[model samples]
Target: MRKLVAFEHMTVDGYAASAEGLGFEFTWRAYSEELSAYGDEHIRADVDTALYGRATYLGMRDYWSAVPDDPAASQHEQVHAEWVNGVEKIVFSTTLESAGWTNARVIGSDVEAQVRALKAGPGGTMQIYASPKLVHSFVGLGLIDEFRIVLHPGTLGAGTPLFPDKSALDLDLVESKAFASGAVYLRYRVA
Candidate 1:
């Protein structure tokens, strides 16, 4: 069976996004070559497709579509952009009628069912990035096989947390890595 992994970077205070409801664009000011390389490698090799909620899908679509047009885009950035734009994007949304991006499919409101089907019939696993509500639903349904929580050095104080509920999850830390940016990556599997 194909695995479903939830990947997100949270702060030391445990918030994925800022209190102002911002994305991860300005969250990590520190740059680590190792982290950048890892992200590039993971997206290109391990990810068969990208799974996202409505908001994330639209945001990524808008951002990645113009990557090639950017005159100042670096070689690595361009490569990463191409890989992400080329991947099969499955967006779960009740409001989205269509997607303008290439290889993008807008799944209907039944996200859980669609995710199950995707997991059952696939080549490689799907990676979901920074979909808080969707991540909560996946966790509640026990659909996520792995959780990659990258803890940044800074603290947001308050924001949308990775896990907002009171459920006591028994997870086993399978892997951990610390980068030069003071970001700690922890991969946890269901125990």
Candidate 2:
């Protein structure tokens, strides 16, 4: 069975994004390093698909698809662009008519069932990035297998939290790495 991995950046205070959804203040400079570790080679070897929410998919598709190939492009950006454009992406949205990115599709049916079916299918692993709402839903369904969280040092007093409502989740720490920038990468498996 393929595993479902949730990857996100969260502040020390647990906010993933601002209330207005304008900024991802939880993101730190070390995030680039963490992301770069999942370059084309790693993604091609491990990740077979991507699951994203409407808002995240739209924003990422627009930005990554429009990025030009220039000398100024950072290695992480170039690798990310390649991975985003090459991998298969499923956008779960109720209002989206169509997806703009290549190898991307819009799913409008039962989210949890579809995701479970996808995990049961023959594949490597499906990765979900920066979709806190979807993550919470999946967590409730006990569909997510692993969580790869990049925790920044700063705190947002009030904003959109990583977890939605109060819920009990028993997790076992799989691995952890701390960077010089006070950003820690923590990997946990659902226990």
Candidate 3:
């Protein structure tokens, strides 16, 4: 069976995204080579599938789809882009008519059923990629098996939160590392 893992980059105050924009572009202003390598190691080898909400799906597709052919992109960027492009992308959205990326599919309804079916199948890890809303939903449904979180140093006073108010979870720490960029990586198994 495959495990459903949720990966999120969040501020100290627990906001996954800031008020101005999605947090990807600026959430980690102190992003370092160490952090980059960490991300590459996590996503490049173990994960074979990427799950996303409509907003995150469109955002990532627009950016990552162009990296492989862009001359100016860094070697790491290109490599990760290639991995992302090749992975099976599952987008959950009621409004999205189609997922335009390669090896991508959209599940418009029966989210719990579809996700459970995928988890029951044989595959590498399936990761929830930076979709806080979807993360919340999966948490509510008790579908996420593990969580890989990068906790950045700063705080966003107001923004999109990673969890809903009054949400609770019981997790057992699996691994942890602190990067030179003042960011901490934590892996937890649902308990």
What TM-score do all the candidates reach, one by one? Answer: 0.93, 0.89, 0.96
Listed per model in order, the count of residue pairs whose N, CA or C atoms clash below 3 Å is 0, 0, 0
- Which residue runs of candidate 3 sit more than 4 Å off their true CA positions? none
Number of clashing pairs, model 1? Answer: 0
For model 3, where is the 10-residue window of minimal lDDT?
Answer: 21-30
RMSD of each: 1.6, 2.3, 1.2
* lDDT tens readout by residue for model 3, 156-180: 7887898877778889999999988
Ranking by TM-score: 3, 1, 2
- Give me candidate 2's TM-score against the actual structure: 0.89
Residue 179, candidate 1: C-alpha displacement in angstroms: 0.8
TM-score of 3: 0.96
Best by TM-score: 3
TM-score preference between candidates 1 and 3, better one:
3
Q: How do the residues 1-191 of candidate 2 rate in per-residue lDDT, one tens digit apiece?
A: 99999887889888877776546745745556654574344433578798888888888888888665666778677867887888899998999989878999998889878888888889888988788888888888989898878788888898777877886788899978776667877888989
Error of 2 at 68 (Å): 4.0
Instruction: Give the range of the ten consecutive residues with the poorest summed lDDT in model 2.
Output: 35-44
Task: In candidate 1, list every pair of residues with a backbone clash.
Answer: none
Off by over 4 Å in 1: 42-44
Rank by lDDT, highest first: 3, 1, 2
Error (Å) of candidate 1 at residue 169 is 1.6
User: Could you tell which candidate, 1 or 2, scores higher by lDDT?
Assistant: 1
